[model samples]
Target: SLSLSLYRAAMKGPGLFSDIGKKGRDLLEKDYNYDQKLTVSTRTASGLGLTTNAVKKGGLYVGDITTQFKYGETTIDVKVDTESKVTSTVTRAELFPCTKAMTTFKNSDLNYGKLEVQYFHDHASVTGAVTLKQPPNVDISGTLGSHGIVFGAEAGFDSVLGTFTKYNAGLSLKKSQTIVSLQLVDKGDMLRASYVHHLDGKQTSAAVGEITRK
Candidate 1:
């Protein structure tokens, strides 16, 4: 049901193989009398920053194929569905030097585009992103953490007004077997909290939230 392997490469870096990266699952009714669903997927990664994933699924026959590939700082994704007769593709690239800064660019067949930049220091990171096409949008986020606690905040800015239009903040804490998180969002005036507990290598989680805006 599961398999894994590791091998050395001459110039492409180390390679790893595992069913953990690619998997297939089938779900049936409680009585196991009829086929309910099926899925097949595969993913691979190497030390040289090469990664790939492919998936196909349907009730009884494979109907679609989706694949993703990443080499070094560039990525490409594609999807094809036989049932719907639809195909889509997207490409992305990222760059980061020895410094604590990174930048990314993304584009899709639908003419969608985005750019992102991030900077990190010690236990903190800041990020900014913008849409590159019409109906432009921008967002900024920052996170700081130390010990067992992490705090983060994000805001969205209106492209035309150049003013913040949305804001959110969150906090997370972890200790031993328990983890807790809280988040607040401005648009819907929402507040959410979640708790997770780990027991004997298993995890159980619960979440509660509320929205005040109609």
Candidate 2:
């Protein structure tokens, strides 16, 4: 009955506690608000750079400007440079419904861009990403399980080189606070094995071994 009265009071204004109710509602609405920042740096003869950043609820936007204002030898020698980027991320219900997923998109004026999508449930997750540019690239990676045995792999293609520039796979076995991992890269051209054991709160022991192609 108390909560019902409070809800009714919050819904209807022009009362003694209406201002408190209005402030509470406003705070809840702006719970995930964002902020903006600006930074400026100048170096003798090097140039001056100003960076601006905005972090939204689930996204980030950045811009940069560089110019030689004080070091230019002549009026025609002065140069100004500018860069801008916008990145955003959405998760699960924010982008869609029901699915446990997250997606990120980023774009920059410097011919750089990226999109990544991931789906995670329980202790397993899968991620896929694409880079946009002259040499566009795509990568896929995933991990499974948290205890006992966990494994993940990542592979990518480089359009510029017309080859797979990224290739890595790893498996980890964990029990208690001890873990052993084996990883390979470049189709077995490189191999690494490591073991890590956690002692007390301030101590740990680890060993690593590696083998490389000749």
Candidate 3:
């Protein structure tokens, strides 16, 4: 009962496909940036936003500019870079109830584009993507259960090679102030486990640990 309440409180909106094991991943990998980065963002009254980010590390500078427009149930994002590469993504939500459709394009290589669709439900989520090339690669992932405890798996198929390129499965459990997760990735070639504990009620401070085996 307590877990259910906590799960409901933590769930703010529709879950994304990658949210399956995101908690553990974030606990182990987030907010540890060692590089210098700067970002400036602005939003207009007409549902348009522009953002530019630059990162400098070890005398290397990298930057990109992105623009986003939102209208009704659709959102479009475009990114431009100094390297003459342009990328765009269009997302439409509520295509049906809790379903969303997304398409991505790359100006440099049309074959690098992809189409993705996602469905999110209270107790489950599913996502599928396919590349635009003739012998496209496809990826599918699904998760089941609520935020308190969930099991998820993902697989990638290479149509040209007629083989599975990748597969991974993970499970995560969240309680009031603790999270534990286990993942088998790289087609079961590697295993990882993580634990996170909030030190305060505000969740601003936490202790996290992770272990991996290959």
Worst 10 residues of 2 by lDDT: 1-10
RMSD in order of candidates: 11.2, 20.7, 7.0
Please tell me which predicted candidate would have the highest TM-score against the true structure. 3
Residue-wise C-alpha lDDT for candidate 2, range 1-214, written one tens digit per residue: 0000001111211211112112223333544544554556555544443333333333655444433332232111122223434443333332234333333344534455565555555566666767756566887777665546666777888877778877777776667766566677666678656555656546444333333342
| C-alpha lDDT (0 to 100) for residue 96 of candidate 1 | 28
lDDT of each: 0.49, 0.47, 0.75
lDDT (tens digit, per residue) of candidate 3 on 1-214? 0000011212332354466456767866777678998999999999999999888879988889999999998889999986868888777766555455566677777445566655556787677777765777899988887748888899999998999999999888889999887889999999988888999999998888888899
TM-scores, all candidates, are 0.57, 0.46, 0.81
Best by lDDT: 3
The lDDT, on a scale of 0 to 1, for candidate 3 is: 0.75
Off by over 4 Å in 2: 1-109, 201-214
Candidate 3 residue runs with Cα over 4 Å from true position: 1-17, 58-60, 95-97
- Per-residue CA lDDT of model 1 for 106-143, tens digit only, reads 22234555565555555666667777667888877777
Candidate 3 TM-score over all chains jointly = 0.81
